[model samples]
Target: MVSPFEAGMFSGPWRSLLSLREDVHVEETAEGDLVLHGRWGDVLLRQPDPVVRGVLNRMSLGPISLSNAVSGHGGGAHGAAAVLRVLDRIEPLVVRTVGRSDGRLLVSVAPIAPAARLRPEPLPADRPIRLSRFAMVRTDGSGYILESPLSLHRATLHHPGAVRMIGMLARATTTAEALGDPPDDRLLVDALVLLTAAGLVVRGEHAAAPAEKATFAEDTDPALAAWSPLDLMFHTRSTLGRHDHDFGATYPLGTGRSPEPVVRPAADGPVIALDRPAWEEILGVDPPLSVAVEGRRTARRYTGEPVSLRELGELLYRTARVRSLVLRQDGEEPSASSRPYPSGGSSYELEIYMTTTGGRDLPGGVYHYDPLGHRLEVVSTDPAIVAELLENARTAADASGTAAVLLTMTARFRRVSWKYRGPAYALMLKNLGALTQTLYLVATAMGLSASPLGAGDVDTSARALGVDWRVESSLGELLIGRPGTSSGDTGRLPVNDAAWAERAAAYLGVKRGG
Candidate 1:
C-alpha cells in the first residue's frame, strides 16, 4: 500500500513547488520530483498542503544515540568520562539515501564523529525507554520504528507529510553536502534548531570548554576574602606601613615585600599625535564637536602638575554620579533606585575609595567617595592607612606601583543573588569591568590616567579595612598626575627600590614590608 506522503508525491503540484536551493532545477516524474541527482538517494520536495517536506526518494537509518558532549576532566570516573568511554566502545553509525527523476533509488553510508565516549552499563529496566529512529510509511499511518542502541531523550516530527527526511539526514554520506540543499539561511537555521532541540540530530561543529582563571575565592586564608581595602597613602607614596597603627593585631613584618610596586609618573609621558588631514576628512562628513572620537594616536606628554581637588570631584561626579531616579513598580509599592553607573539589577554593590597626594584644601589622605551625595568621606586622616591600602592591593595583585587605587567590595551576595542566582560571580566581574571602563573614560576626558588591576591581596586588605571576611574586595588602581619628563618625575621609583619592595615582606618576616 502506498503511503499518504508517497501518494501525495505523485498527485499534488509538488513539481511546481520551489527547491530550497536556487541553483537546483525541479523536475516532475512518475516516481515524484527530483531535487538532486546524487550518487545515493535522490532528494525530492513533496507538497503536503501547508508545509512542504523534503523526503528521501529511498532509504532507512538505523539506531542513534542522544547524549551530551563530554568536556574537561569529566568531573569523576562515573560522569562525563565514563559516558564517553562507553560511546567509544559501541561505535554506532548512520546510513543515507537519494532519488532520481527516473524513480531510481540510491543509498550511501557514513560514520558519526567521536564527539563523546560512553561507558557501558546496564540501563535501569524500569526507566522510560527512548526511541532513536522512526519511519513514516504515510502521512497518517503508524510509522515504522527503528530501535536506538542508546535511549532517545526526546523526539519531534517536522511535517506530517515527510517521514523520510530524518532517515535521509541520518544516513547521508556527507552531512554538509546534504545540508547544502536548502540555501535559505534563516530556514536552514530554524530547521537545525528544531532538530537539535528535539535531540533528533547532531551538528558537525564542536564547542570549546569553559575557561579557567585564578580568583580570590581560590585563596586559602582566614581573613582573606574576594574583596579587600584600598588606602592610597602607601600606594601613592611607594612605601608600605613602615609605621605602627592601633587598628588591629599586626603580624610580624614578613621578609618578603609586596610584589606590587607603585606605578610612578611617566617621565616623558605617552606621546599621542593625530593626522590632521585624516581627522578633518572624517570630521567633514559628520562633525561631532560635543564628543570627539579620536583615532588611536599617541597623546602628547604632560608636565607633572598636581590635579586640583575640584578637578578630582568633577571626575568622580561625571563618571560615578547618580544621574536620575529609576523607578519600577514592585508587587505593592513602587521602588525608586539610583546608581553611579548603570546596573543589571540596580544592586550598586561597588564601593569607591580614593587615594590622593596633593590637592588644594585637601590633605594627602585616603578618602571614600559617596555617590549618593556626590561627596568624599574621610575613611581615616592618618597617612598610615594609605600604606595599609597599598599593601593590600599589592598583596592581592602580587605585583607593583599603581597610583590612586580604587577598591570595590561586595557586601552581600544577597544584593543580587535573589535576582541573578547561581551566576552572580559572572555578573559581579562584568560590573567590575564596567566600573573600570567608566573610570577610564572619565580619566581620559579629564586628561588624567587610570589603570585596572585584576590581582590584589584580599585577606590582609579586608582586615585593615575592618570589613567582614565574606565581603569580596578588588583593587582598581588609577595613577593620576601631571605628565612630565622621566628625569623630573618625583613619583618615579628607582628600579632597585621597586625590586626591594617585592622582597620586603619576606625580609620583614611578614606578608607586607610594613
Candidate 2:
C-alpha cells in the first residue's frame, strides 16, 4: 500500500488509546458497524452513519483530502459539517488504514504530534568553519561538486556565491565576518547549514581533533597495495564491464601482435635449446601429489652448489610450456595457447625471464624463457647487471647463498586488456599466484629448492632487462637452487610469517600479542 505523504503524522492525545486494557479489541460486524470492546463497556458506530462514513472515506484518502473535504461542501453541507466535527475530535490522533479484512479495509488510529522543523542558528563571528577531511570537492563546467569518500553523498553548488564560499572554506577555515558582507554572508551561512546537515563540513575546532584518517586501506586487499591506480583502473575498466562502451564485443585474440621476441639464432650468441625430457620417466621416481604438497616449503637458504641446466629446463617445461595452440576460423575469435596453469580468459599474459649466476650449464647472464620454442634467449650479457639482478633476488628471498637461478615474471598487459576491462590486472595477478603455486609444487616434486618473493623492484628490473616498462615490467620474482644441507638449520633467512604478521599488525594498528 502507498503511504499518503511518504511519512506518517504523529499522534498526540490519542496515544492513550494504545494503553487501554489488553482485552480491549475493535471488530467490525456483518451489518457494517464498528464495535469497540473495552474494560468500561462496548461502544458501537451504527451502519450508514453519515459522520462515520465521511470520516472513514476522508481518512482513506489521507489528511490532505480530509482538509479539502472540510473546506468544500462536496460531501453535502451536513455531511461536511459532521466530518469537520469528527476531525476536530481526532485532531490529536493519527488515522491510517493497516490493511483489508474479509471485504472491509482495516484502520489503524494513534495519537501523535508534529515534528519540529530545523532552524538555522546564526554563525559565530569568532569561530571558523572548514570542510570535513573526508570530503572531496571538484569543479566542472556546470558547477562545483562536493563528495564525501566516507559516504555516498554528493552535492552540486551552481550559484556563484555558493561556489566562492565553498572555495574559500576549502582552502582554510574562515568566519562569516571574513567571508564578505550582506548578501554574500547570508548565502555563506545558508550554504554552511546545508553542508553541515550533509556532513560535508565541520567546525574548525572539531576538525582539528586528532582522529584516524579515513583510508581506502580499510576496504582494499593488503596484497593489492603494490598495484598502481592507473593499472588498477585500466584493469577494472577493461575487465569489469563498468565502462560505457561495449567490452569483449570483438574477438581480441589476434588483434595485437605478440610482444615476445622472435628467436633467430645469432651467429655466435648463446641460445640454449631446452631439452624436452620425457615426463613419464620423471614421474616414475617423483613423489605423489599429496607428498609433494606436504613437502612444498619456501626455501630461503640455498646451498652454494649450482643447479643443472637440465633441471631448470625441466622445471620450465613442466610448469609453463604451451601445451597446444588453438586458431580461430574467419570472423571467429583469434588464437590462444593452453598452459599447465590456468589464465584469465586463456590470456596467458605472464612471461618468464631468468638470471643465472652459478648454474652448471647456463652462463651468468639474463635470458628470456621461450615457452613456444622450449629454449632460453640470452637478453643481457653484462656481469654487473646480472649481479644486480642476483642481489635483488637474494634480498627478496632473504637468503645468503649464490643464487643458481632467479626467475623474473612480467606481464603483457594487452593480452588481457583486449578482452577484459577493470579486473584485467587483478586477473593477471591471480594467474601469477597460480603459476607461483604450480612452481612451488613442481619444485617440491623435482626435489629442487624454490622460493617465491612477495615483491620485486619493477623499475630496476625493467632497466636491467632493457625492456619498455609500459609494454612489459616485472611483477614477481622467484629464486631456485639446491636446498641447503646444513643440519636443517636455515641461516638468517627472512621468515615470512613474522614479517607478514608485523606488516598486518601495522596496517590494522593492532599491537601484537595484546
Candidate 3:
C-alpha cells in the first residue's frame, strides 16, 4: 500500500515536471515534454510556469510504490478503504481545491506541538548503529494503526511542502483512498534520495553505498592492515577508550529495557587453578598492583615455569568479577556496574577459560573458570588441544613447561547493545583489549610470563572448549606460562627501535617523542 507520506505528496498542486512514456516511438516524438515510463504507467509531466517549477523542484516525495501511483488514478475497483492501506504512514491534515483546479487536491500540513520536541531521549552519535521507532494512524478517523520509524515524527515538517506539489497531479481524497499501493524500489529509492537531499530525512550506514572515511586512526602494522578495516577501526577506538576511561556501556534496548540477568551456576569450581601455596601467595600479596601511567607498558618475557593456579585465580578475580553493589537516593536500588577491571558497560561479559599444559595443582585438560564460585570446572582431559593451543599462540613448544593457557571470551554484548545499538562490534573489541592488559599486568606482577596472542584458530579452539560461539569466538588470546629464553627465536628476528618507530609514525602520523 502507498504510505501516508506518499499520499500526502501526491495530494498536491505545485507542478509536474516529468511523466512516464511506454512506447519507444512515444519517447521519440515527445522530445520536449518529460515522459517517464515506469511499471505503473506512462506519466507525462507538462512544463509549468516559472513559479510552479520552483515549487515542484523544492517539493519532493520519493520513491514510493508503483501500486500507489496506479491507485491514485481514481479507479473504482477498490473502495477508499483499500487506498487507505497504502497511506498508512501519513497523519491527519486538510486539503483544498479552487474552482477551476477542482481535479487538484491541495493539502496543507498541520504544525506539530512544541512539547513533542521536548522529550530528551539519547540519540545515536556514531555511524553504523541506529535507534528508531514508528507508529500508525487510521483514515476513517478510525482504522487499523500502522508503525513507522520515530525519525518520521521529526521529519513531519516537510509534509506541507510535499502535499502542495502532489495535489496538482491527483484528485482530492482521503490518505488511504487517494493512493493505491506503496511505491516499489525504483520509486522508493529515487524519492528517498531526493528527500534526503532536501534535508527531510537522513539514513544510517547503508549496505548500498560505500563506507565513510575513518575517524579513528588505523593500525599501522601492515600484517594487520589487510584485516577487515571494520575490525581494525573497532580495535583502535577501543584501545583509545582504555587509555582514557575505566568503563563504557553497551545496552542494546536502552536502560529502560535492561533487565537483571538471572545468574545461575553454570559450573561449581574456582574460576582459577593453582597450587595451595602459590594461590595463597597470589591472594596474599601485600597489595595488588594498581594500573598506573608508568606501569602500563612493563610487560616481561616468561621463563617457562608453570604459572601457579592461585595466581590464575587472583587474575580472574581482579579483572572481571563484580566487586560491589550500589544504590541510588531515589529509594531505587541501582545495581553497581563496577568490575575488578573496567568494562564498556559494567558488563563483565568476558569469560576466562584455561587449557592446562603443566600446572602444579591442575591436570592437563580444559576448564571453565567459574568466577561466582572461584573454582575451575574441568571440561576436558585431552592433551592434543594443548598442542594445537601452542601452535596457535606460535608458542605451544615454548609454553609447554609454563603454567596453563588462559583464553578469554566476550559475551553479553547485548548489555551494550541495549544502548550503543550498532557499535557492539567495536565495543566488544575494546573490552578485549582492556581485559587482556589487565591479565597481562596481573601475570607480570606475580613473576609469571604474560603473552597476549592476537592470532589463533579461535572458532575451532572455542568448540573444543565446549563454549558457545558468542561467548568464545570473539576474543583476545592471552597465554600465561613460565618465562622462556629470550636468546632463542625471539632474538633470531632483528629487533630494532626503528620498526616500532615506523609503526608508531603510521599510527599517529608524528615523529617519536624525546
Candidate 4:
C-alpha cells in the first residue's frame, strides 16, 4: 500500500508515494495530544513522540516514500510499522501518489468515503476496459480531476501526459495496446490501476482482485435503467452516503460574513400591496390535516373564471410569506428565516414569481412576491413575455388555455449555495417539494384547483422575472384556478383493502400477517 518514489533516474519502475494532503497540518495540544487536521476532517492522536512528529512534518512538505520516510530516517522497522498504523487511522487525510519513471508525479488519489481503503492493483493484461459512464474528468484549479459518484476515492491528474493517458480509457483499450513507442511509459498502466481501484474505470467482465468489476456496456440493468445520467449525478452529489465534497454551512466560498442576506431584497419596482391573511383566522377556517392530506390531487383543468386577487393573496400568505428573520451569523451560526414551509438549515432561498394571466382583479404581467413585506413587486409588465411565461407553465402542467394564476418558483442559488456545497442544489429541490406540498394542502382546504408542475425553463423565467439566471433560477411551478365542473375524481382509496394488501405481499414474496 505504501511505495515511495525511489530517488533515482527514469529507468526504474514506477512507485506509489504516500504523504498527508498539502492542506493538512499538525497542531500539538496543551494535553500533549497531536491533532492532524486536513480538508476532510480532524483526527487526534492521544499522545505522540518526536519521531512521529518528524515524519508528519516531513510529509507536510512533500510526498515521501512511506518505506524511506519511516525505516530510512533514524527510525527502525518497528518505528516505521508504528507510523504506518497512525497513517491508517488518519487515512482519509492522506494522498496516494504515483510518479512516472521520470520521477514526475502524474496522478494522486485521495480517499473520499469514511471507510475508503485505496490500494492500486494491476489490471487484467488481456481484457479491454473503459472509463465508467458515470466517471467524469473536469478541469479543476489543479489541472484536471477524474471523479465519479461511484468512486470511493477521487483522483487528480497532475501532468498533461497523465490527461492524455486517461484519454486512452475513453474506449476499451488494453494495457499492451496502450504501450507507446518506447514501451517504457507505464503511466497508462499505473493510472488504470489507481483509477480502477477508485471505481472510475470498468472492464467487460468480472475479476477477483478488484472490489468491483464495473460491468461496462452491458445490457440494460434493471436497478439503474430508470435513472438518467444527470438525474443519477444529482441524486448522489446532493445527499450524503456517497461522494465527499465540503457540505453543510461550511461557507467554503466566503469573506467571513454570510454570503447571502438574511432576506432577499425586493426587485426595484412599485410594490403591489396584497392583503395579508391572519394566521389565527387561517388556523380556525382551514380544514383539518387529515382532510387536506387525503383530498390533495393534481387538478389540471381550471374553470374559465377569472381568479380573484383575494384568492392569490390568501394562498401566498398561507404558503410562503416570511414569518420572521433570525440573524444568528453574528454568533457563527448561519442566518436563517421562518416560513410556512421548512428548508434545510432554515435557508429559505426559494422565491415565488406570480404570473398574472387571465386574472380578474390583477393586471396581466409577471410579478415577484416580496415575502418579508407581503407585497408583489412587478418584474415585467410586457404583454408578450407575460403570456409566454404563463404559456410555459400551462404546458408544464398540461392544462388548457391559460392558467388563472401561474406560480413560478425560482431559487436564489447563492442563498443555499453559500451555506452548502455538495448538497446545495439538492436542498433547493427538496425545499421546492416542501413548499409545493404546503401549497397543495392549503389549496385543497381553500377549494382552489391546484396542479404542481415538475419542470420550468430557467432562462425563459429569468427573463420574465427580471433576474439573473445564475443568481436566481426557477426550480418548480404550480397552476391555480377556480374549480372546474367535475365529471369524476381520479381512482384512489384512503386505505388499502385486505385483497389488495394480499396481492402486494404476494408479488413481493412476503407473507401477509392478516
Candidate 5:
C-alpha cells in the first residue's frame, strides 16, 4: 500500500481541515464578551485572546487547513497551536472535511453528538478494514451520505469514488487493494481514514481486540445480536441520545396545512349510532379503581353467552370515546382531545375497528368505531375476512375458545407525526399500550375478558376495512369475550405477580386441571 505521505499530492485529509458551520456565528455581548451561537447551541467565550477572533473569522469564511492556521493569524507555529486550541474549545460548531489529491472534495464529516470532535488522520494504508455492520449509505441530493446509528458523526460523500470505496469495505479490504493502480488511490484511502475516525468503519481484525472485532460480527455480539437492521434504525431514529434528526413538536411540515382531523370522519357505511351511558351513570356505577386495576388478566375461554351491543358501547365509551375536541387556530397544534386513556402530545392517533362473531344485537363483520359519535361504521360484512380476522386474533392471543369480538387498532400516522417528530411512531405505540390497558380494566369492570394480541395483519385489516394501509395502518389487536367457567384461571389471582408465581410453583401438579 502506498503511504498517504509518500510523495503524493497534498490534496487529501492527511491532516484536519476545519470550518465553522454556516449557521454558527460569533456574537458580541453588551459586556464586550464574545459568544458563539448556532446549531450547536450557545457557547460564551470568556476573555478569548485576539488571535482566537482572527482564527474564527477566517474559519467562518470557509474551511481552513489546521496546519496552516498560523497563516490566518500571522503568528507561526505557536499561533497555529493556539488556533487549534480554540477549535478544540468550539469543536461542536466545527465541520471537518477531506479532499482528493486533485483538491476535489471527497468526504466531509460533521459532528452530531454534542461533544464529538473529529481527529482527522488517514488510516494506515496497509491495514485491512471493513464497514461497520451498522453503517448505512444513502443518496442525498446530488451526493451521498454514509452514516451509522452507532457513530456520533455523519459523513457526506462528495465523490462517487468515496461511495464506491465504502461499498468495497463490505468485507475487510486494505487500502492497497482499494488503491489498486493509483489513478485516484489517495482519495479512497483518505476517505477510509475519515470514516474510520468517525466510528463508521471497522478496523481490521489485526488492529482490533477480540471485544472490538466482535462488534463487526453482529450475531456474535451479545449487545447487538437481537436487534434487526430495520428495528435498530427505527429505535435510533425515533429517539434522542443516539440520533441527530429533528425531534419533538418541531412541526417540520410548516403548520400551514392543518393536521389530520381529530376524529376520523365517518367512513361511508351503515353507521350504528351507539347509545352510550351518561358520564354521571358511569361514575355512579362503575367498579372502584382498585378493583379494576388489581383484577384484570387474560382469559381465553368464552361462554356461549352473548355480549349486548349496549355492553360493547359501554366498553368503547369507557375506554376510547373522544370526550371533546379542541381546535387551535394558531396552528401550533391541531384538534386534540380528551379520552379515558392517555396519549403523547394529546395526539389520540389510535382508531378502533372491531370484528365480531355476531353479538345478539350486532352481526359478525368488520366495523370501525367512530369515537366522536359513539358508533360503529360497518366496514365489511364479508364472512371470510371477518372469520379470518377473529381466528387470527384467537391464535395470536393463544386462546382456545372462539373470540367474541376482535378490536383492531389502526393509527392515522400523520395525526401524530405532523405535530411530533422523532418519537412519533414510538409515542403512538405508547398510546396503544395506554388504550389497551384502558380496555383491560374496562372489561374487568364489566365482567368480560379482554385479550391484547401481540401482533396484527395490516394487509388483511386494510382489505377488510376498505382503507389504504399506508394512510391508516393496524398497530395492535385485542380479543374481547365473555368469560366462561372452563376458561384459564387467569384473573382469579389478584395482581400480586410474585406471590402468584410462588403459589403456582408449589401447587402445580397437585391440582386436577392445573
Candidate 6:
C-alpha cells in the first residue's frame, strides 16, 4: 500500500512530469533555434524572441505553458506563437484543461526530460534531487528510516517535512528548488545536511554503486556471503547498544512454555553414578586461589595417563552442577533454579556431553552429563565416534598426546530467547566464556591438564550424539587429562613465555628460579 507521503508526491503535480514519453527528441539547430520532434509534430523555437526566452528559462523550474508566459507580457497572436514555439522545444510536452483562473482559461503544461544530475553546491530552487542506489529507505508507524549500508550510517526522520522530502525524492528526483518555499528554512537545510553527510541523498550528477554489488565486493567471509537482509537485521537489532526494543521485563512463563527440564532423562541406557565430593574436601591441602590463578595455563599436551572416573565426576560437579531449584509463589514472576556458574536471566542453558577414551573405571564412548543427577547417561557405544571426538580435540590443541576426556558444551537457545529479544546468542556466548573459566579454575585446583579448544565440527558432534543441530548446537570444547612430567610442549608455546613466567612469579610472591 502507498503511504500518504508517497501519494502526495506520486499522484500530485510531480506525476505529470515523470510520466512523459522518452522517445521524443530535442536538438539545437545551426541557426541557434531549438528544434523538437514529438507527437505534436516538428516545431522550431527562435531564440531572438524575448518572451520565448523567458518561457524557456521558466521551464527549468518545471513544465510551463506558453499562454501563461505570454499573458503577462501581452496577449498577441505573434507573442503566443513565439511562446508555443519555445514550449515545443521541450520534447514530449503535454497540455490539459483545468479550472478557469482570473476569468481566463487555465492550461496545465508538462514537459518531460532526463533526470537532473546531482550537484555538489547548495541545491538550486529549480533542480530536483534523488536518493542514491546505495541508500535504503523504509517507513514504520513512527517515522521514515534511511540507511546507507555501504557507509554504515542510519537516520530516523520523524518530522513531517523530512518525511515529505524523502517521499518526493522517491517519487522522482527533485530539488529543494522544485519543492518551493519551505515552512522552516533552517530546519529544512539542517535535515538536508544530515542526509547528505550520511550518504542517503545525492544531488547534481553523482551516481552511487548499487548496494548488493558493493557489499559482495567488500565482504571477505564466505559464511557471511549467504546472509540475507532478515539475518543481518536480526543480528544487529538483537545485539546490545543498537536500536531500542522491549527489554528488562520478566515475561511470565506461559502455560506449557516452561523451560525444558534441567536434565535430560536417560530412557534405558546405563547410568554411571558420579561421586560428588564436598568443596571443603576438594580444597584441602590445595594451593590458595592466588596460587591456582598464577599457575593456570592452557595445557596442550597430556601425560598419556588415563583420567579416573572419579576425577571426571569431580570436574563436572564443580563446574556445572545444579545446586538447587527455587520455586516462588508469592505473586511475583515464575521461579528459576540456580547453578554453579552464572547465566543470563538465570537461564542456565548450557548442557555438557563427554567423550572418554577408556578412562579408568569408565568405558570409551559418548555420554551426556546429567548435572541434576550427577551421573553419565550413555549416548553412544561406538568406539570410532569416540576416537573421532578425541582426535578433533587433539587437532584443536595441536598436541601429540591423546586427550582422555573431551567436553562438548551445547546451548538450549529457547531458554534465553524466551525472555530476551536480541541478545540471546550473545548471552549464550557469554555463558560459554564463564563456563570455560570455571573449568580452567577447577582443573587448575585439581592438578589436572585442561585446554580449551578453539574449533569443533558441529555436524560431527551432532551425528555422533544423535542430537538435532537446530535444537542444540555445540558452542565449545575442552580437552582434559593428567598432566605430563616432561615439558609436554605441543610446539605452540607463547612467544613471551619467559617474560610471562617472571611476571607471574613476582605477582604470586614466588622467586623466578624457585
Best by TM-score: 5
lDDT of 4 by residue, 44-154 (tens): 888775567677877788776655566556787566666767776777777778784346898889877777776555666656677787788888775898887667788
| TM-score of predicted structure 2 | 0.56
Q: In model 3, what is the error at residue 474, expressed in angstroms?
A: 3.7
| Regions more than 4 Å wrong, model 6 | 1-236, 244-256, 330-334, 485-514
Q: What TM-score against the true fold does each predicted structure earn?
A: 0.37, 0.56, 0.46, 0.81, 0.84, 0.56
Off by over 4 Å in 2: 1-270, 331-334, 485-514
For residues 1-514, what per-residue lDDT tens digits would candidate 5 score against the true structure? 3322122222334544567777788887777667888774788887766667676777788766654555656666566555656666777777777663235777888877686755645566556677887888888677788878878888888877777777787776666666664425555666677788788886664544322342344436789888776788888888887656779888877865436777777777588978777888777656566666655668767664667899889999888988777778875544678988999888888899988878668887888898888899988898999888888888888887776888889999988877788898999999999999989888876767778888888898888878799888999998888765553445664564646433432232232121
lDDT of 1 by residue, 339-395 (tens): 556655565556666655434556766566655556666655566766666555444
On a 0 to 1 TM-score scale, where does candidate 4 land against the true structure? 0.81
List per-candidate RMSD values in Å: 24.2, 16.5, 18.1, 7.5, 5.6, 18.3
**Model 6 per-residue lDDT tens digits across residues 390-412:** 88889988876876888999987
Which is better, 3 or 6, measured by TM-score?
6
Model 5: CA > 4 A from native:
1-16, 28-33, 46-51, 119-126, 181-184, 205-220, 278-285, 301-306, 327-334, 484-514
Q: Candidate 2 residues 1-514, lDDT tens each? A: 2222221112221111111123335566898886555433565656635555544544443433333343443455566555444444333233322221222222222221222111224455445566665566677675566655332234556456555666666534545444654434343454565465444665544332122222223235566556554554455445522222235524345555444422212324567898777968775656656656655667777876777888888899999988877776663543678898998678888889998774556788888888888888888989999999888778877887765888999987766666664456677889999998899878767767688888898888999887788978788889887777434433757654545533432322232111
Number of the candidate with higher lDDT, 2 or 4: 4
- The stretch of ten residues in a row with the least summed lDDT in candidate 5 is 1-10
In candidate 4 the C-alpha lDDT for residue 7 amounts to: 26
lDDT (CA) for every model shown?
A: 0.36, 0.59, 0.42, 0.73, 0.74, 0.61
Residue 429 in model 3: lDDT: 73
Candidate 1 or 3, higher lDDT?
3
lDDT of 3 by residue, 159-243 (tens): 3333332332122122222222332212222333333322223334332212132221222345645656345434543443211
Alpha-carbon runs more than 4 Å astray in model 4: 1-12, 23-57, 74-91, 180-184, 206-221, 253-260, 266-268, 278-285, 325-337, 486-494, 497-514
Worst 10 residues of 1 by lDDT: 13-22
Candidate ranking (lDDT, best to worst): 5, 4, 6, 2, 3, 1
Better of 3 and 4 by TM-score: 4
Error of 1 at 483 (Å): 3.3
